[model samples]
Target: MRDFSCFSENGVQVADAASSSNASITTSSSKIGQNLVTCVYQCRLRNFSSFIITITWTKNLMGQGVSVQIDDSTNQCLCKVEIKPWLFTKRRGVKNVEVGSKLIDIHWDLASAKFGVSPEPLEGFYFAIVVNQDLILMLGDMVKDAKNKIDASGFAPNVVFVSKKEHIFGKKAYSTRGQFCGKGKVHDIMIECDLMGTNDPCLLIRIDGKTLMQVKHLRWKFRGNFTILVDGLPVEVYWDVHNWLFGKLMGEAIFLFQTCLSAEKMWASQSILEPSWSGSLHRDPHTQGLGFSLVLCAWKNE
Candidate 1:
């Protein structure tokens, strides 16, 4: 695990993860060009054991694909299933993976999946993870079809949405959808930064078409955070645009929208650092009411 440094600025505590060679937050130009969305969930397996499941959707030159990985509480990868990108074949299949002594069945049907501009499916799909005839985790809109195919009972699986990481690209403005809390309203998030031919650029953030936060002199305050109210809850927005302002041509910026309830207390306590999207699932932020985090790796389209 990497360490994080926290400091106070204008009465708001800023937690920054230390730079590391293997940091997943930094996305290269080649990877930034690919559309990817990774969602993490905390689920209970057999014997009430907790596990973290990561589902990543990808779309590139080849085609669209999805990968599912399950990790135990100790951060050890239990099993992983990758559906490689296919050009013409039906985008669906089933894979049975052996984890320890248990046989985990992974089922996905995207033959009729609907997608917008993102790689993730908007609907008309079903992804299910079954352990011992019990559905551990399920996604997409075709729940009935999934149950019938798996021959499982009709019951909602107990799972907590942990975090989501996505790559967004644009020349000066980037937009995406986000849900801050469980069962909360999904809002449209827009980030605008006009740096072309400007010495001092300003950063603007809007939620649901409403301007919520703005930062001027972005070159000077390239790395900072602010808090805003959404759905009657406080959401802390952290951004690090050092790369966008001074890094290489293809460098990308990072923006994190965190909906932790006790954010201020967590910052004051400094017990646990903000973990990376790929490596933070084991901590189970949902237990502490830390809420969900949406990480956006914003890239400039050249």
Candidate 2:
């Protein structure tokens, strides 16, 4: 791993990694280095696979930056840039919620699957963790901080609504369940998923729900492939493309969209405004990057 403590000319730290797993990069301070603005350094591994570096630090401002680049296929070492945050003692009372609550209740499971089940109202929902602990903790902290802001602001901030749905493929049958928002106004959705638990990153999709479509792990910016469906049948059409980007820390992303590919055949060719959304946090901004945190919030459409 490369140490960018000195090379960051713009207060932005830059590090080059030869090859490392679960790489832990740290800064000299608790807050991101002064006037530090950092972005992911485009990188390439081998000749075909693109490598995006992930940085885990106390705050998103500095420390780690992840970037994806089209294959240059010639460079020996990849440069991953980051800015170091000011390292400070963690505030007290920052504790992990015990693993007492079920990660996903049966109701949520059914709903996420979009299976035909009775709607059981749930106050909140949780998705299993996929990313590193530091990232998760950072997400929890950011959500908590955002909640604190909501409570203190006194003015009613438009709550972003999120609903969970799932699709299942077994040896014999396939089915979907939950409050799916397929054809409606765009809403913010956070999905937690694993593609066969292989960690093979895949885009997530949903069909037959009240919520439109959602993408995961888009802490930066992204444009999605357009697909549509009708009664679980493809219409072979594409709609106006939607774009999702997060400049903030987004906890473990649910990037397993299996239905988006299947939905393209159902829609008529028409230009529609793509849904624009943003998140409040970035990759990981936990107290000390311990990476232990959970998120739950209420949602309301504007």
Candidate 3:
């Protein structure tokens, strides 16, 4: 195995080192047969304290479901609510949990939620998190219904999407969608690596069907990174495919799409590796001056 401790400066590390430090990544990656999409958002609660809300959507043999977790700036878990797999009576419900002295309410109605190939819902759903009677985070297209049901109205919650982590499986092509910046247009991201019956494998990455980066001599350069432009923003693309090139048959590859305007400055500083799997959600985005990050764990399907 390659020593990844030295690559901390560039925010890239070997899978073993990365997984050992991040419990979430280890947990998600171990579920090789399931599809998971975890989104992290930063928002200030009614008390003016910033908190991180992690929402994870899961799809497996049982069915599809969602889980919500709130953690304070100190990385202390305040509360968590999990909506079990779909069933007749579990389609819609509300859960109230007391965090410290504050009561947090989680409301969701996924009975009519529509899903695509991904576990995340596409429409016909409303997921709202209320704190101190104020709607702090809201998701889905049922905005009017959410507002009516919550019975709290003022201005929209000031939520900043911090990062996203998804687990995708494919034979030779892995694909997903991502929004590089806030309120930016979503684009299709496709990663293709054909290693079957060939002496050499090449890596091709495309955005919106347009090739952005291509690497030859895959065996010699299987683990590296490059800079790309998306929506006029500087994005640092990193990949670690050591497992794919040399590890077990079911080994997965990790790709990170990090958007940070100060990427140049960041590269200059001696910072530890903060790959998407490293759990960037624990850090405050505003204070860190970090942009959105998307981490895709691509598993090769046999």
Candidate 4:
């Protein structure tokens, strides 16, 4: 009888945000919600079966909370659970769920977790999901603790980070960190573009401290994709800053850096996503790694 809220059982959970005095978090879906982070992972069961799991971690007036959703190949959700911010409750717990006649267990520990500017836990935390007694998907840095708590049976699940949808707030310059490959170093990603008064604006992307790519005359190229090298990996960067340059005062921009995939091919396959702000975070679940997709939905703070 855990205090978890079962938002969706074999379906979808509606994202609704309300105001509270909590003061830290601002929104619900991370799309409409401010100060939120959403991560999506594709994992296969030991039986060669696969599914998509979306985890949205949010902070708002009430507190910091997390919402998890599991969906099948057809995008039909299986089960979803929410861990709302609480006081006097265990920051770590376990959940037993049933989806499609399968028994799944979700374990989490974040008692000592430390966070930076983002709501997502940076370290000292773990979120593990077990299905059929196999470690299907696990996240966080406390691997030894995770292994000790769960039964490490069968083979490790073939998991791939399909995509991420993060809402980042900034004015002219927005920055974040990214690891292009599991073995590659995490580089500081900064996107600097000015849309103040100049008509001939430019989009500049920097890795760590070095400028990787710069697009001049951005007004004519506000919506396009390009490839740049970071840590010796070809990362395709897609950007849609239409609203930022033309629409609203504090409009948001969408940028994506998908490695090991051609921005041209991804651009051609508009059916999948088309690399636009309107497109939800999507990727081929069967996509093999060392490939990962990073989406930054940047909202300008006026």
Candidate 5:
């Protein structure tokens, strides 16, 4: 747990200095550039039993950026840290902050981090946290390098990966990579929906090029959920495509996959939800919700 209150002096910027080497992910038309991916984790702190951390990776015509937000059990934001995509001088640094009279340090090294199509790094990087001089959490695959940056006596922090949300853009087919289980195998997710001129549009979802589920007459079945098996575990899939067919131009469809159903027993009640798609009021009772949700906001490009 790094301190975020003093984000100015201990290295702020995180972008690479190689202007020409760093690439922009935007295409010729700018409609497909404003996309971001977010990964949520539930970290149990020494004091609070329920603490949430959200890591958002953003990229566009400008460059790549990273933002971290921490919330306690009451859903109150404790601290936030944002690293800009320009001025790569501060790519690797540390920040210390005081919360509840305890000192916390956050260290990160993204200088040599390898990035894929998204702004998040695939490997060769690490983000570490130390609370009261004790190591609490560590992210990325570089374990040995990260441990070297933390105190030797501190052990690993208790952490659980909760959910993920990402905005995907495509004309008729949307694609993304998702890992359903914890540190599970990453699978290529493809969603195909062609409602161009047909009266009865269809929806199809695939994993690794193999069709897993398909929905016909999507107008009536625009909002619903079903169960499917992936890697021998039951996965609940819910979809809301009401906008993609008739809402507005370039409307996006919402798809959620509650993989593993390991969250809570209350989530099973969402199926018989009286007011469907009204997830607004669901904040209070299900603060962190029940399962590991994979939310995909699929945007269609005209």
Candidate 6:
């Protein structure tokens, strides 16, 4: 049984006065009694925008802790406050696991442009999944590089704390996880595409799949620019598609992603395998054109 009374602030957990680094808190869910709380040290990472956090409480507090990693867009401490009472008793020989959400809205800028190649936050780039409230996996840059064959995937501490059921209440551990797109219900499908590659120009088309297409006819219009339409209707698909396409061409990759309001969707993105550089003005010999792509994946309501 982890100790919930040892916390200081409303949700701030304070460890020993001598060890503030390990300070954590506990909060109760309206539906349940109390849930464990985890904190991300935002100040520690100088130029980062988000922090991933995880929590662990007793079975009475939901058995396993409700783990969800949230991005701090405002550059503040984003905490996951679970209001449920579920006791989590660890089985002597069984392994418990849980997969959380994805951080699919990360923006890439100059910091990642050095080699004409950009990289997601080495630590905060991936999604966090928890098991039985003890074991966890922070899959970020490691999985990516591993997938790319540039690095290895075997890393520890990537899997956080682990403990038995009866010993959870008064004990302390660390882990992280988050929710993306779904509000916790469950979404098994997501469009997975990379916005960082140069050789290949990928196209993502957005459409109203729910609606019927007449003759399957589409028009392409270029007014000092490129434009495309669906069912003879003007849309911003061109802009959205190009942004993702050229961003990858320019070497800025979209490691994270989201979608729009309508059901049907399409867009284009590129990627670069080598390091490159970009400048504002054209140089003497290499009249390099400054190319920029502005892709908007998440729907914006005006």
Sorted on TM-score, best first, the list reads 3, 1, 4, 5, 6, 2
- lDDT for model 2 comes to 0.23
TM-score of each: 0.82, 0.18, 0.82, 0.80, 0.78, 0.18
Clashing residue pairs, backbone N/CA/C < 3 A, model 3: none
lDDT of each: 0.72, 0.23, 0.73, 0.70, 0.67, 0.23
RMSD of 4: 12.9
Weakest lDDT window of 10 consecutive positions for candidate 3: 17-26
Write the residue-wise lDDT of candidate 2 on 1-302 in tens digits: 11112122332211112213223222122111211111222222222233232322222333221221111124333332222212232221222222222121100011112111112112232111111121211112233433432212222222111222221222111222221222232222222223233433233332322223333433212333332333342222111112112222222121222123332221123121123211322222211212211121111111
Report the error of model 4 at residue 94, Å: 0.7
Q: How close to the true structure is residue 54 of candidate 3, measured as C-alpha lDDT?
A: 92
Mind giving the per-residue lDDT tens digits that candidate 4 earns over 1-302? 11112222321121112212122322222222346888778888867888889899888877787889988877788899888644426589888898768888888898888887677888999988888787878888898888778876843567877666777776677776656654356566677777778878888776655555666677777776666666556677777888888778877787878786555665675543333435655665555543687888888776
Residue 179's lDDT within candidate 6 is 21
The ten-residue window of minimal lDDT in model 2 covers 102-111
Q: Candidate 6 residues 243-296, lDDT tens each?
A: 233333322211121222221222222222122211111111111121112221
Candidate 1 positional error at 58, Å: 0.5
Off by over 4 Å in 1: 1-34, 264-287
lDDT of 5 by residue, 150-180 (tens): 6634567777777787888877777777777
TM-score, cand. 1: 0.82
The clash count of every prediction, one per candidate, is 0, 51, 0, 4, 7, 49
Worst 10 residues of 1 by lDDT: 1-10
Task: Pick out the ten consecutive residues of candidate 4 with the lowest summed lDDT.
Answer: 12-21
